[model samples]
Every structure is written in structure tokens, then in C-alpha cells.
Target: MFGPRRAVFLDRDGVLVVPQFREGRSFAPTTLAEFAIYPDAPSCVARLKEAGFFTVVVSNQPDVGAGRTAREIVDEMSLRLRHAMPLDAIKICCHTSQCACRKPQPGMLLEAARELKLDLKESFMVGDRGSDIEAGAAAGCRTVFIDLGYTAEPPPERPNKIVGSFREAADWILSLPQEDS
Candidate 1:
């Protein structure tokens, strides 16, 4: 792996699909029936693939640890997401705020960088939350924050770019200077 490939690390819940909302808060789908892939997500991922980027999904599913959802359901969702899109890998953290692999920690992204032989500097992380941006920055990847207007608080850290949807995120990544292998 002398010349590592660049990756686009995606957050699953809000970035790939419409998150389930209740009482003004967003939650992951706990069941296969509730999993809904956004209309543009498949094409957005396809575009990233076409642009020579390895697309990986890094997600936090804390409900499983909290007993709000089952691990099987979470696994099912991951399977469905991978089946629906052109993802190279899916990394999930199911622990409730106590694990290093969760968003805001960069463990998952770091793991992917190691396992996939990725160049973090040439990578981009796309997510709709501050934790996602923080994790990407910690992992030394450029961050793309998808602003869905769900939070009043500013991002935990500044992102390299902020866009309104996954489509725009992919476009931004494509616009960057291509890294020479």
C-alpha cells in the first residue's frame, strides 16, 4: 500500500437517509421497515465512486446499548444501507457514549484508515452533526458538514466545508485537487 487511496467517510443516519424524528430530535431506524434511503443518496454515493473515492460509512448507533434498539436491527440497517448504495465498508459503534469508536472520537475513521490503507489527508468525512465533524477533524481528514438545520448549537469544530445535502458534499469532494498516486 505505498500509495493509499482516498476515502469519503459518510455518517449513515442523516447523511444517507432521512432520520426518524420525534419530539424535535432525530433517531436512527430501529427496524428494517423504518429504514428509508434518501432519494439522492444512491446517486450521490455513485458519484463519489465514479470520482475514484472509496466510500465508507461510519455511524453511531447508541440506542442498542441503551436498550432502545436491538443489535440485530442495527445490523440489518447496515446491511440494507450497503445493499442500497456503493459503500466500500460500514463501521458502526453501538456503545452508548462510552466507546472510542463512536463519533466525536475518530476511532472508526482511524480504524478504516488502517484497515483500508487510506490516506487521511486526502479523505473527507461527510455528516450532518457536530460530532461527525469533530471525529473527521480528529482523524486528520477534511470534514464536510451537511446543514439540515436540526441543531441551534454551532458545530463542535469547524469543518473544511458545509453543504446542504450529500449531493453537494460529493460535488465539493470532487472539486478538490486530486491526489496523485
Candidate 2:
């Protein structure tokens, strides 16, 4: 019998979309107007899907908990992301760092694995931040860090691979050995 399917988990802002910047600070989009997807995002997602991996998105949106962005706007941004890519699922943690679902905690990836019946050991998580790497590592998934020279400190746990763009990340994931059916 086949075991759980392999999946590629992605981080939304900074990884899938062009992160918004305000006063030299990086931030997720607070409104639909501020949301902008990277040009390569669709193609990158499509490549992963075509390689027979389920594509999922795991994101941390702490602004919602901080009351800097409305839940409605977050939902709208999620809708746009889904419309823009062929993701199998998108798991969002709208809570603060204390929440278990937040990145660096692995709750989102773990929940996605449970819901999607994914083999975490055979899966991969790609992101731009250290928390994303830590989350993927904690969840037992290999990680790919898209290095965009962000100012944030590195993740405590190192990712399996570090690349310059999502395209490179897709290439790396596609090159991995396929899991047994």
C-alpha cells in the first residue's frame, strides 16, 4: 500500500510574493493593493506540481494578531495567492510568535501534513526566513532557504539547501529522489 504523499511546503511573503517594505522594514501585505506576487511564482509552483509533488503553502501572518492588518485583508490576500498559483493547500498562522502555529513552531507544517496525509520525511519546505527553516526542520521536512539578503538573523537550524530564487529552489527539489509509492 502506498504511504503518505510527498509535498513541497512554501512560505508566502518573501518567498512567493515580493515582500512589502515600509520605512526600511519588511512586512507582509496589509491590503490587497499591497500584495504583489513574484513573476516566477506561478511557474515555480507549476514545476513542483508537475514533478508529482503536492504543493502547499505554510505562512506566518503575525500582523493580524498585532491588529496591524484586518483578517478580511489577509483572507483577500490568500485568495489572490490561490488564484495566482496551483497550490494544493495554504496553511496560515495568524497568531503571534507565542502561538504554536507560528513559524519556528512547526504547527502549520505539522497540521498540513496531517490534513494532507503527507510524508513529512519526504517533503520539503521552502522559505525566506529563519523561522521557516526552523519550522520545516522541526516538522521533519527538508528545507530550502531562498536567500534574499534580508536583515533578519539566520534560523537556528540550517536548511538542507540555500538558493537565490524560487526557481533555484524548484530546481533543487525536482532533483531530489522520488519517494516510493
Q: Which is the leading candidate under lDDT?
A: 1
Native-vs-model 1 lDDT? 0.88
- Model 2: per-residue lDDT, tens digit, 73-114? 888888888898898998888887567889888998988888
* Residue lDDT tens for model 1, 1-181: 3345989999998899789876555678887788899999999999988877889999999989999899998888888888888899999898886578988999999999999889899899999888999999999999999988775556546788989899899888888778564
lDDT of 1 at 170: 87
Which residue window of length 10 is worst by lDDT in model 1? 149-158
- My TM-score estimates for the predictions, one after another, are 0.93, 0.92
Runs with alpha carbons beyond 4 Å of true place in candidate 2: 1-4, 22-25
78 in model 2: Cα distance from truth in Å?
0.9
Best by TM-score: 1
